[model samples]
Target: MDKSSGTVGVFTAADVAVFSVMLAVSVGIGVYSSYLELRYRSRALRQVITGALLINICIYMSFCLYAPSLALATVTNLSTSASILIVGTICTFYITIGGVRAVVYNDVPQTVLMFLGVLIVVLLVCKETVGAAEVWEAAGEGSRLEFFNMDPSPYVRHTFFSTIVLGAFVMLYWVGVSQAPHQRFISVSTLPTAQG
Candidate 1:
């Protein structure tokens, strides 16, 4: 990064190399995991989850690909549909061969990339706007920080008690009783490890 221009606008060769290597490593991990895949059980729960997950994938795959497709289209001649097809195919290919194990492994790097991407955007915003402090101060001066609403009125969109209670219930349902979480839990070996 060069800040001599009063801003970090360029990605250096080292940055490119690091990003390229990280992606290559992540893909290598994913492919290696595919070779290690093993067959698992058959159950009604799995069948039901598969049907629901397919419907979700159909809807969310478009949502997930839209932003990236726009970005790719901006820089390349690739159309949005083509970009989506390429990405979707690559994703489906991995899951086809590796089962959930590949997803579990690939998720580690994907999550890292997601966080790193957000962090880079945030840092750039901070840099462009002078500093994080000023940006935060501006936000705090607005309705953004007015999160704690103690009003018990039903007309209120969000309230402190309602938020806390509903959030707790949602968390409980997802963490303890959700099929997705259950699948993750059972993915691990041993009862104690699964519980943990």
Candidate 2:
């Protein structure tokens, strides 16, 4: 499908398959690397966290370089897309490497700020648009707030149940094994401090 500016953003079935394969490969790499880290019993967790941060920074830096290059030279859309995809994948790689502690500690303030910003935008949007009563009426009729809809479809992106299940899994994985989360485990001076 083309966007308003006539940019081809939608992919063919083959492209979808390729994207899926790339996603699976990235996930597999993350799982495999984590297993290696655990099995080797090497490197303090903090180093891992720092390394992940550095990796992500590097990935973003590379993209920054590419953006300038794209503007200066003639590059195909496919090349630009691939470069962006590489940056995104490397970002995930950085996260997986940084571990849980890095993710959580880094995210804590950002998450809070994100929620506040989102809430402000939502309130503004609501005030500018229909009033609360109309919003509720629309929601009740499932015009604006349906996930699975009145009827469930197998291929839908996510139902509430599916979201809960996936969210639980993600929570467990990130909280249990992430370096960012693990840092807190090791940070306490003593058991008493930890308890406090």
Each prediction's Cα lDDT score? 0.60, 0.55
Error of 2 at 149 (Å): 6.1
Q: Which candidate leads in lDDT?
A: 1
How well does model 1 score by local distance difference test?
A: 0.60
Candidate 1 has a TM-score of 0.56
Tens digit of per-residue lDDT, candidate 1, span 1-196? 2345433434345533543343323333222112112112234434554576568656766787777778877789998888878777877798789876566556668989999999999999999997999889889888566678999876777789888888987775455334444444445555554333
* 179: Cα error in model 1, Å: 3.7
Q: Show pairs that collide, candidate 1.
A: none
lDDT of 2 by residue, 63-124 (tens): 76677556534455556656567655766687688854455456657888989999998788
In candidate 2, stretches whose alpha carbon ends up further than 4 angstroms from where it belongs are: 1-109, 136-143, 147-154, 188-196
lDDT of 2 at 94: 75
Error of 2 at 111 (Å): 3.2
Residue 76 Cα positional deviation in candidate 1, in Å, after optimal superposition: 2.7
